[model samples]
Target: MTTAFDTAARPAAVPGDTLVLAGRPLRDHAVLEETSRYAEDVWVLTPAWLRADQKTLRLDFTLVPPALVDVAKPLFLALLAQDTPPGELPLAIDSIRTYFGCARRFLWWVHGRDRTLRELDGEDLDDYHREITALRLSGGATRCNRRAVRMFWAYRNVLPDHLGQDPLRRSLWQAWARVHRRAGGENLTDRIPEQVVAPLLSWAMRWVDDFADDVLAARAERDRHRGPAARGP
Candidate 1:
């Protein structure tokens, strides 16, 4: 019901005279550079995010999509206000922020390099996937990249389900790159060796077991007047 960042969002408002916009008058490059930091601060205040580390703060700001950044300014500030000062933003809110930031970076290539989403065809998608591979994000961050792509396409589906970490499902993505001209990602066939996979899987299984145990432990106790049954006997 709450509209966090629905309408009003703005970066820190210094005195008008003290604020000096950088880069071209209309480019908004300096504003974006600072805005990225503002976004990072918001990330710091998120409970637990999809990204594993702080590298999201290092995202490229080449294009700074007008649609994304211009509106996001107000959206970002509004989200911060919802978090108040010391409290952390919820996980869903953090995921939304990551999705927005990722798409904003992707649009840089599509918009700044004079490439339209249509050009996602040909060899472009292949090259774009390569760039994503080079991004060096952790397992969780890679998941965020997939989420960004899902949003960029305006799909009603959540990326985690349709485009999970499972390498088997990735093959279907080629159609997206081809049809939307939005190139696909690097082949993850052997991207993650078993050495890494085994441990993650083990840890996840253990956590699931721990969760089930807690559920059992929380089972409610029923109190009754058994003395009445004994008197009847």
Candidate 2:
């Protein structure tokens, strides 16, 4: 199930041969291809909308950089052992590949070629996030970038404990992205009106109070069951 990328693992395409994205060379396809026994297909996606009933989805060749591939070959091989369905295995593999590619692009833009992942700090991450947001890449693409960087840190066990106080960073950025887009345009309004907040708060507060009472009762019952000798008499 390993998909390690090395000279032996290279596919039909190669170092001299190029993988093209919009007519420009993106990377060597051989380096990016998953060579696992489970990898029966390769899929790429372009953010097209699909209906809920749609079962068949088409993917193109994923764009990746050779340098990033070299850096992430271990992660790539690790993904081959994941439990993706046969039909979706290719997409799953490419999704992980795309994530690393996006992270590589961000790092390249920021540090040229000198910085190590261990040396990256909160300021560097902040700058990268701001730059990516300004670029306004497709939501899926942006998410890949965020997820890949997070996973890399998670793998190294070095993820930041505090992500600062930006509301976007504190909450799910994807959900907020949807809300921001809807506010700018797109009108399908099942969203709660601002005026409904006060009543909703009142309703929720009642549940909170009831839950607090239940907790107190449970504590009292536990205390009562303790024998006098055991209850610090």
Highest lDDT: give the candidate number.
2
Worst 10 residues of 2 by lDDT: 18-27
> TM-scores, in order shown?
0.33, 0.37
**Residue 161 of model 2: what lDDT?**
20
lDDT by residue for model 1 (131-176), tens: 7757877655655665455433222111111111222135445543
> Which candidate leads the pack in TM-score?
2
Per residue, candidate 2 scores C-alpha lDDT tens digits across 95-171 of 55456566556646534535655555666666666777778887667766765555444333112221222324434
lDDT of 1 at 135: 86
Candidate 1 — worst ten consecutive residues by lDDT sum? 155-164
Candidate 1 — what's its lDDT? 0.42
Query: For model 2, what is the alpha-carbon lDDT of residue 83?
Result: 23
